[model samples]
Target chain A: MKIDKSLLTGSTTMLILKLLEQSDMYGYQMIEELEKRSQNVFTLKAGTLYPILHTLEQEGRIESYTKEIPSKRPRKYYMITKNGRKLLDEKKAEWQFYATAVNQVLGGEGYVGV
Target chain B: MSECNLLVKEFLNITCEEIKAKRVHKQIVNELSDHIEEQTQYYIKQGFDELTATKKALEQMGNPTIVGKELNKAHQPKTEWSIIVLTFTLVIIGGFIQYFVSRANSYNSHAFFRFLIYAPIGLIAFFCAYFFDYTIIKIYSKLLYSALFISTIIGFVFINRINGTYLYVYYSAILFIPIFAGIVYSLREKGYFGIILCGILYGGVAILCLFSVRTIAFLLLSISCLAILTFAINKGYFKCNKRIGLSIIYTPIFLILILSVYYILSAGHRRERFATMFNPENDPMGAGYLSLLIRELVGNSQPFGLSQLKGSLANMKAELILPAYNTDFILTFVFARFGYIFGVIIIALFIVFLARIFTSVLKQKNKFGVLISFSACLAITIQFALYTLSNLGIIATFSVTLPFISYGGLGFITNMLLIGIVLSVYRNSNIIMESL
Candidate 1:
């Protein structure tokens, strides 16, 4: 099922931080990985991803570095900072709590019977 | 292949055109073009032709204008308004102080008019530095350093001295501090060799200071240069082991410190100055005279009102009036005339000015900006501290100007220019990329 575009907006930062938390990534790698991991439900545009990445970088949540890859152009990679990891944890808890609350409000398993 | 390259270049140009920060356009374009090329490779692997795949990648990256606009928003050139505002406030305060101090001493009245002229000239110099592209320093680091070094040596020998001090000569040499920062930036990739090169350059300044007998300028320049070098080393800009880098930088300074201490102890006049530094009563009418006078003046000063000392600075024969009241001892004059609170207000303003400069310095991402701004901050702050400490009799009295507040001269203009460079670094903080 296609996720609503608006539904993904607020979580994009959390997702990007979460992705960087696992390993440092360049822009294109992060986008492709996000799409594959989300089963193609979260195909982020390069336009959208870079702006968010740059903003996180400015906030010191993430930092960018240029790494030379063998036989290829130097790539600018973004790594999650300590602040970014702490923020990701907080975001994860908030997401869990939010999802649980929304499920409960919609009656969840109780609504399954209904 | 060529067709595909043209297509990618056009997309990059359109996208870069949208971003207003022209400095970061290359970096952002490099990054975006990499993304497009990667996407095109992926599509080609999935069976699309090079041109077709390039078109597909560009389409998926979304609209060029929107991407550029967003990138532009993220990379706008930053201006530090707080610094600009504080500098103006300090300059005006300095103007008022100079006016009043001149009014009190007719012999020094020309200083007020000079202040009128130098203050605007200094402000023009400040803005000129603020608007200048500091990258020019990076590009011309060695050339600037060599030219300034040679000229300073020439100035030392040829320039006429006023009252036994090389006023403009040493003042011009102070410009070496920031230019050395550029030199350090240019030498970053050379590892330990870079540190040694920097040490050699700094040794030149130290030797110049020693030969010219400008102890205070030497002390100020050395400490400021050491701070800049240490900061760069600690930031790992030199790409060498931090411990070794620090040791390489400090060993010479440590040796110099010991040697200078030994030299001061051995030199008859310097030994007398040193001994009197601790107990001014020993030489009440000679080397210790100024220290004792400062103590007497400050000791009797009231917090809210001027001191009761009655002597005309214009006459130069009074027991109470300090020498160079308009230049080096302006703070003491302010305390004597305007009260301690007013003096504290000036010091507090400097503290804020320094604090603001440092805060801006910390926000810099570009290493070149960091070096230039940090060195400027240290240079200015050191002069301000040394002058204030000297006025309060905590340190030996020397010929150091109180940055903006001192009667306007070459030192004041240099300080203004340094502040301008710092502001320029802050102004380009966001737009410039960190060097790899």
Candidate 2:
């Protein structure tokens, strides 16, 4: 199966942004949520996921806070920034357009040459 | 719930402080434990026994260190400003000790003159290093290489017009120019192979231009370059066989060049100095005088030494010794005057001085910082060691000057430039910290 290395990161970022849009979560919860939401179709490796969180934090697209949970360790929880919400909306629109264009071709219809 | 969880939690707590990020540790522990628990629960739900499920979950967790390290890499905090300030303070203190205290007792007009001439050169080298962006230096490696080549050639051609010995005049810049350029280019280029090539080329030319006047200085310079080359190779910046082959090729070529130059510049007294070094009795009053005096001072100071400036050996009543007491063999002079206690103190100070520089180098996180700082430290430390060893008769007298303490323009300026390079590394480390 061919994989676009470039798309992997952007998709992971969008997935993270979308997930955090629901509620703030730590790294493990984020990974679990992504897996559960996608029915294991997207297994976000810890290595790939943390850098995206850090990059988002650095970009001010997300903000993180730490809270101690009883019977478990303290976790750094990431929440989407206003800027992050804005970016997520724009990315959703762009991805919708891209998915439709690709699906049109994959759906067995010949390209209406433009 | 799993064996791996217990082991990983223990390991993570123990190593977390070393990870450089407080936030990362919390994130990693939480994430890893949750994942392990989830895996164990998943396996148990699939009808495995509890222990068996835990074993499977633990196995599927992969290496905790690999996972922990990836997390650490992603969120490692920029080095704190306190660390940078502490490093800079230590380096400046080291430089001050080397300059002032190390050479205090040996004050003289010649020493002052040497300082005056070389200090400006050192300051220029320092500023050049201080203000120049290391990235720009690396990006224009070829340009720096060409500049070094052209300058060396220009100095060589103009050697005859200079006041000093032809060789000394021609190659004085060899000490700092190539080293500075090498470091800058290496840092910018992401490897020191280019710097090593430039060093070898410059060193090869120095050997070609060698004469009796600066043979020892040239040898010391070449050895310093080789030390840096060795360090670069050890750090994996250059491939092993390539570096080894280059050294092997350079050595024989250097020897041949030196032999030819020696033949051209060989004067009666210069040849006699070489002969007398082997057997000082051959011309005790002539070329052998300095070596004999050095041996006598060091020998007399054994177990413990005579009082400072009090050794009759250094006084040399009616004996032919070098006219100046401290120019070349200041170590011996210091030992004779201050006794073995002072000698040990001086050696200890030099070791401490080198140790501090090395500490700063090791603390640096970036590759360029490590290489440049380490190279400069190695150069100074080896020179100091060789000078001390030769003075104590542990090696042949190579006419090497004690760094910073020695009274020579070239030696002094080169020493300052080295100090400057180290400081530049510290400064850049601060900038990196601030950026983070």
Candidate 3:
């Protein structure tokens, strides 16, 4: 329930990369899908989302293009690059270790069984 | 149906390319058309109208700029370089004026010495203004104020040591200090308090130190009037019609009070000077002498002017009329030799020069531009007015010169620096416009 916003920045990038690994998506669709898949637990404002997208594009971790959709407005779609995939893999392993460590501490019943 | 399609087409045409305009257009058209058709069918099934539902659907789409913002997001950003260049150019002109005039007026010194003293100071002031981020200046407004305060104190203290009663002290402290403070305050991000304080401090010093109650009274009155105007603007008191009427009434009454005081404190010789102002026959051998001589020079001239340095009135040895002809009454001397037409031309040029500064200020967008433009304009204008009044024998003779045209080193340098600030404001205006 408690989340450090600064820590969430890296997590956000990891989430973006993993989502792009599945399929190319624009900013609005990515935000909508993230909220839906997480059961509405996560949401990103446009200001934060656009700046991250720009940073990722500048770093060549992702590429974007204008995509036209039938019966809907066209969107700026971003896809993960090879570098982004490698980065996502590294981040996933790190998150797994961090989650296990946190779970172990919370699950402890006694202090060294003294 | 045709009218609806035409509206959709016009909406699509107005949309920018940035926001996937064509795609959004297609989607809106399809969704709206489908909804309208469905609603119309539902209404028909209920035994109602078809056109009403379609009209209702179209009405809900709202204003276009809301949609246009989406398209604008993709547009490339560009910086306004013209404004930056213009601001930079004006600041440089100010520096050059200071340097060139100082060099021209330096007496018994080599040109190299003049350049050595003036060049580096001028360049540093110009470049600092050009390269320094204006935002940074704004953020550190307090530091700028303290620095200006210190410089004013220094200038005020040292001014008394310089030669010439009217030339060194009043010109430096009275005119220059407040103007410099205005420029500095304008450049910084702070409100007008620093400039207002500067004006008060300078005016205060002139009152306390100058030993002339008449001069002090007038200077204080001027500062107070300007301060009140500035305060009214800041407080938004000018918004009310009643406040405007009050200000109109208050100003002339204050001016009359200052004039009455000036007359009361004026010495016998000073009174004689005023008498001569109205009638040249009051005492031609004494107080009326300068006025009568000036009248002769102005009245005798043709269109172009008398030959340079050739008037009988100016050449004291040739006429045996007045003593100390070259210095305190220099304008009269210049007019006598050069003629009234030439005097008129010089005054016109000064007016044109000040007008140019006013024009530049009017064109500027920021508060800094407004304050600096007005302060510099007032400073130059007042000094020129004083010089003209003294020359025409309308006021007690004082030795202030017409800026740039006059032959004084310190006054000339100070004038150049003032011009530089005007240029700085002009340049700033250009930059702001370009950014827009």
Candidate 4:
């Protein structure tokens, strides 16, 4: 099933937090990682990804700094805070609960049981 | 390759049209451009030609406007409405404090009405400052500072003079020393020249104050501005060493020492206030009289006692215990009439107001905005602290207003104007902070 834009909107920060909860990453990295890991199911525009990252940075759930590497210009990297970890854990449970409920509703109970 | 660069520029430029604070939008532009270039390079490594790689990169990033709008949502200049609301609320409270005190003394109620009349004017000043693009101040900060400084001198030299020597003006006028300092520093950039220029503007004003409006309150204010300049320089205002900045930053401190020494040796009304401050009881029937009155009223009032307001009111009306009950000593008026509970509330509000200005300064990426907002905050903080100290008999009663709450046209109006500047800075604080 195709995911709704509204659903994507709601989960954008949670997904970013979840990604950052594992490793520090830059904007393009996060975009590529999310798309790759989600089996090409997620394809967020840079425009969509960055504002969420910036907002999360301001919310103190994530913070950013630039690091220099050999043979490249410095790039901005983001890391999740403890608060972001807490939020990610909560979002994980919420998604689990939500998906299970949807499965139950869409499963055998919805057709003629009522 | 050059054509490819143009495409990236066009893309990034379109991304920042909605964002104000050019520097902030520039950072976003450059940052996003970095990502685009990286992606284009990735495409090139995948066997695409340069032109195709660039085209593909642009296509993948999506429309610049949509991305720009999304980014703009986070970077929009924010106004501190909580501070604005708190300021208006306190101004109303001040009006009530004045109204009730007037009524308490003479059984007349128009002072509050007068304040009500004044409220709209103050609110207009506040909003005008809030909405006025603060960046415009940079273009004419020199002219603005000179005008304020020259006008002060002209006001002192030609407009008002007591006994052709002792300097005095409306209490509100004195508050401008610190504000003018803010304006002075707002025009500064990162260098020794800016520091020297600040010293000139501040020193000229300080000297002008010395020969004319010789108020100790302003001396403290000038010193506070120096402290603000020091802070601005430390926080990337100048390229000077942070430790060395402290030593060189004594421009105001040095001015204060010279002026104090001059004031002491010159022998006039200035000497008496210092002597009186350190020892309030030295001359109970003379210079220390008002300070002593504030002390007894505040020191003796019941904490959280409503009845005490009436008692102070009756005492004020029945006997000439404290004069200027409506103006310089308005804090005492509120404390005496409304008791300590209301008094603490007023102090808390002032602290909150200054905090609002301070927080706004911290968020600013524009150096001018940060310095300007910071100086305004420091000046007002000093005024509020000194007023409270004087009211509690902890410091010399310099007769400064309690900012928006004080009963006077110029001080009240000027206070509103500074708040407007703070609001304007807050409104335009989204300067791209790549370095800061």
For this target, which candidate reaches the highest lDDT against the unseen true structure?
1
Q: Encode model 4's per-residue lDDT on B180-275: one tens digit a residue.
A: 545545544556766767666666656666675556545655666667776766675566676666666575567768986897868866777568
Task: State the weakest 10-residue window (summed lDDT) of model 1 chain B.
Answer: B311-320
- Residue-wise lDDT of candidate 2 within A41-83, one digit each (tens)? 6766664676577667755688777677798665567888898
In the range B219-242, model 2's lDDT, one tens digit per residue, is 655665566555555555543455
Model 2 misses residue A109 by how many Å?
71
Cα lDDT tens digits for candidate 3, B289-396 = 666666565455545535233455343321134334333454564455446665676666666666676676565444544555556656666777887776766655
| Candidate 1 whole-model C-alpha lDDT, 0 to 1 | 0.84
State the lDDT of candidate 1 residue by residue for B1-436, as single tens digits: 5988998888889888888778888888789888998999999999999889999999989898898888888877678888888888888888997787667768777778899889888988898999889889889999998898898888877887667666665685579899999999999979999999998988887787777778788888888888988888998999999999999978877897899899999889889878898888889889888988887676656786667554443323222468888788878777776678888898998899899999998888778988898888988899989999988878778888788878757888899899999999888876777843
Measured against the true structure, the TM-scores of the candidates, in listed sequence, are 0.93, 0.50, 0.46, 0.75
Position B225, candidate 3: lDDT: 37
Model 3 C-alpha lDDT per residue in residues A14-81, reported as the tens digit of each score: 88888899999866567668878877666644335544665565445777665676874554567888
Q: What is the C-alpha RMSD of each candidate to the true structure, in Å?
A: 2.8, 20.1, 23.7, 6.0
Considering just the first chain, candidate 2 attains a TM-score of 0.85
Residues A14-110, candidate 4, lDDT per residue (tens digit)? 8889889889999999988998999877877787888888777655577778888688778889898887888888988998999888777788656
lDDT of 1 at B169: 52
**What local lDDT score does residue A2 receive in model 3, on the 0 to 100 scale?**
47
Ranking by lDDT: 1, 4, 2, 3
Calculate DockQ per candidate and list them: 0.67, 0.09, 0.01, 0.41
lDDT of all the models against the reference? Answer: 0.84, 0.60, 0.52, 0.71
Q: Candidate 3 has what TM-score?
A: 0.46
In terms of DockQ, which candidate is strongest? 1
